[model samples]
Target: MMRSILERASHWLALVCRVIAGVALIAMLGVTIVDVATRYLDRLSDGAVAVTLLGSVELVSYLMLCSLLAAMAANVEKSQVVVEAFSHGLSPGFKHRLQGVYLLGFAALGLILCLGLVDSAAAAARHGEVTQDLRLPMGPIYTTAAVLSLLLGVRALIHALLGALFGAEGEVSHGE
Candidate 1:
């Protein structure tokens, strides 16, 4: 019963993350298109309007970061990468153990990244850091990214535990 609840929760969380990432990606694409179009228009008009999107670079950077962080949990859940070359001849049991170890290591790395991001966010908050043009506070963005990193760590740890206990067959489905 508990496992089922956890599985459902994880699936829902992954779906949310994927959706957020997709939105961020679309926003970035739109922003880039507008920026480019405006630049072209400015050139065509010989600087008559001098139109340019303010803080576009900063906004896109933040959006890209958010998208990457948000997608990470889903990617980890899906095991998106497959490197069969190294483990081609390995037995299924051995491969499962190896995968478990890899997932645990990834969890540890995520934890470290989350801690560092938290510290960075705190420092940004304390220093009143802001982007050059938009004066947008970076503390919130960093904090959000840190939270996503923590979620990724939790997901990795869960996968590691499941793999260790039940081999490759014990996967938590993300509702297909």
Candidate 2:
């Protein structure tokens, strides 16, 4: 069977987001490991060899944000927490529609997040904002976040459409 272009595109984009999330996770781990090591080194030196990673805390914070945001776009559907209690008695078709409606809510939220981030990024750029410790430009980070958030919205919207029009993730709706 041939798959729709939307399905293909969403799959590819989700894979990319997963990769980005993986990289962010690795970077976060490295930063945390180094920061902890520095703490241990400081103790070992007894205040003589005071070495620090300066902005390690700030770096980790941004990395953590990136990790979570990158994972969001790809995993929105997979990560949804369903309270089956209310809908357990409903038919599968009805349940699928309900899930689609739920995803639409998430799509709306993602778009709102994207818009807010875009505004924040523009403001940061205009004000020459920088992170407190690392002095890294805030505009770029916020812009990246905005882009990821947009992807999240788009992905969720597509999934919502598919679920509403068709059925659940793998089930054929009516006659296919």
TM-score of each: 0.85, 0.89
Error of 1 at 173 (Å): 6.5
- Model 1 scores a C-alpha lDDT of 0.78
Identify the runs in model 2 with alpha carbons over 4 angstroms from their true place: 1-3, 170-176
Shift in Å, residue 50, candidate 2: 2.4
Best candidate according to TM-score: 2
Q: Judge candidate 2 at residue 152 and give its lDDT.
A: 89
Residue-level error in angstroms, candidate 1, position 88: 4.0
Minimum summed lDDT over a 10-residue window in model 1 is located at: 167-176
lDDT of 1 by residue, 1-176 (tens): 54455566667777888898999999999999999999999999999968899878988998998899888876774673547888789877666656767789778877888999999999999999987789988799889889888878877777676657555524454321
